[model samples]
Target: MAGTVAATLLVVVAAYRFRSSRQDRSLPARAALPGNVNQQLSGYTFTRSEGGRRIFTVRAVRTVALKQGGTTELEDVVVDVFGREGDRHDVLRTGLAEYNPQSGNFSSRGSVEIELNADPPPGGSNGRQPAYLETSNVTFRQQGSLVVSDAPVRFRAGPVSGSALGMTYATKDGWVELEKDVRVELQPAAQNVTLAAHDPKSTIPFKATAGPGLEAGVVWLTAQRLRYDKDSREVALRGPVELTQGNRRIVAGRGTVFLDSRNRLTEMLLEDGVHGFETTDNSSMSSAERAALRASPSSEPALAHSTQSGPPAHGTESVPWLPGSEVQRERGPLPEALEASAQRARGIFDPASGQLRKLVAEGGFQADSRRGGGDRKQPSVSRLEAEQFEMTFEGVHSEPRSGVASGNVRLSVNSSATSVAPKAVRGGRPPEAKTARATVKVQPATQTETMTAAEMTFDFRAVGRSLKRAQTVGAGKL
Candidate 1:
């Protein structure tokens, strides 16, 4: 899109200057023989060349010189820009255009359409769709390769499409800016892989495996404005940016995306009041705040955190507990799930496999989870608070394997009720298992355990949904 805009702007400016200069220099001889129009030309064609090679061509079906106004109007204008060695090219078309010789300004009266075709990048397939753009009310500055449009613009490249309220392109500096209400959508290439489920019989829970490819997904993004800098190969999204893919979504105050030499997205950075969320199962949701996500094609995308690994101060020791009745009733509505929020959050992902590797939250971090009633005899809730919390995922299923909480770590586990098995009858007389005297008694009690430590580690069970073991290290209390 950027390349096409730059090339089209350059061609339009050059064509206007060249055509108007030639017409103005020859106008004196035809001044006495014309009305308002000095000369009318049909089938006008202009070409620019460098080093004996044609660079671009401009054509018009008809052109009329306005003798009194020193301006020229063109109909059915088309500009064809040739790339190096003629290996690539772009075509620009518009219904009408006007050039002011005195001010050297060029303006388009109707909508402009541009199509760009370029050779495939290294390692890419030979066949690819051309990029297209459409915009109206375009104007070019006379002194520089700057083009601006106050009207809306739409651009499409491959499976990506975008729109903006207004736009500006600077050919000389290779910069493009979308003024307001920028929105983009990308349809990612499909992968035919299925995620592996946890093995029920395996002792080791959540083994990592490179599973089958995943289906293609769509990514949508919106921002107040967007700017692209060719020199740094970066695009910046400003103010109230949002990105959504599948059930996952991220919102931030600002974001920046870096592109590789091939113009592929390689890395991204988001900051300022960031919030991320994902819907797992049922109607529940997980969310985080003040988070940042960094993704790169070459390495795992990572979430960063501040390090804190120590016990709390000597004066702070009290821990709060929930009532037994409340804990029991809460089990009904709360399903097994995880929730976290912090001053900062970071995540890492496998570039090739597109699997999340790890997530780390730091700076006043807190995480909470509720065990599903179906998974355990006693439903329980666990809460952890510390300077940092880290979770690691492994295997083909992308199941969480381990977690660590560090720096003034405090963990609380609350469970409601326990099941008691019925006793067997001594006499073999048709075991009266359902007898009133043989019935199991219900236990109405809540168990609340709290632990404090410098750091704590958790190992997950085979299903990866439940904790198998947890231990604290360094000056710890239970």
Candidate 2:
């Protein structure tokens, strides 16, 4: 009787273990498998969480229906797992897909869809919201590769989608890699924008690519860097910021575009660089900016306003857009006069026929009438370029209502004008005006029509209107 009872107890324990293990085992779902790991899974939801010392919870929900040889394997798989940090969540998720005893490695796919969510690892105070990653109908190609179309992907508040390819990512952790033929449209906070990054590396959770005539917001301004804040609805950028209105391209260094209540690229700020403006009326290249952006494109020494450099600039609440409301097909000095354009390796000898590029910037800037200007209603700045030359003011301006004029530029400078203040006298004794004078010399470059300024400060607030305002000037051989 004792032996029989012991045998019965063993049988009951075995039955319980088998039943529990069978119910808990998680298998990777596949859509269609040839002979390899060409696994395709969909309708799968995965969630992973890890906390101090011990990994707490992990779960996946998926349904797989596939054809192998001639048979179909369809199963509703739920995976509940535990990990010890030694193995990250992705490793586990990837391993689960590779658990097929028959297949060596997963390959190909009719379609693979996965959803992943990760909460802040639980160890300390957890009041912060976790980052969420969600994507659907993704046709996963290989382990780290997937091709999908019309599937929306988002991270914090940013989301982008539309016929995506060459996106290597792990849904388990929040990551989406974009490469080759990348066109993304971002509609964050205040503005709707599009970016065509030939090669873009983005970890932004949600990203969407919009199509043409989509009016993302403003027509669009470009540069090496363009960023927008979703919360504040602000956009900011540094380096070759260019605005395209119709066919004109306005270029600048650092600038901001403010979105109006109507969500438009409104006010602009072009800082630390000259603006290059281009006209749709490229009547043809009268003169091209023979700019050769060598491997080293260093900026001129910092002027008083040249402080922010070599660091990431945060977006401002609202700022002036550098190239705001660019003039369309307007006439100017040269048919090809532009804001700013890029220069390649070889230099340009004949811009009219040379490979010319320049950057143009046009935006409202404050002109101190009492000092910054002598009631000469200041116009917005337009800069052109050439080898060793940065030409400013594409054309003369029209008296603008903003006092901050737009159109072109106008200025008065003497070839050799001199100045002397009573303060400059050594012993507090007043010196004769003509004897204590200092001269301002303006020189022109050899190959370009630009007059290079040695960058001098003039208290010309009281100076006259013409080129010969105060002192007698000298003439240089041009």
What TM-scores do the predictions have? 0.57, 0.31
- RMSD values, in order shown: 17.8, 19.3
Best by TM-score: 1
Candidate-wise lDDT, in order:
0.61, 0.31
What does the lDDT come to for candidate 1?
A: 0.61
lDDT of 2 by residue, 70-98 (tens): 22222333232223342322212222232
Q: Which candidate has the highest lDDT of all?
A: 1
Give a tens-digit lDDT track for model 1, residues 8-56.
9999999999999999998777346467888888877877565776655
Q: For model 2, how many clashes?
A: 41
TM-score of model 2 vs. true structure: 0.31
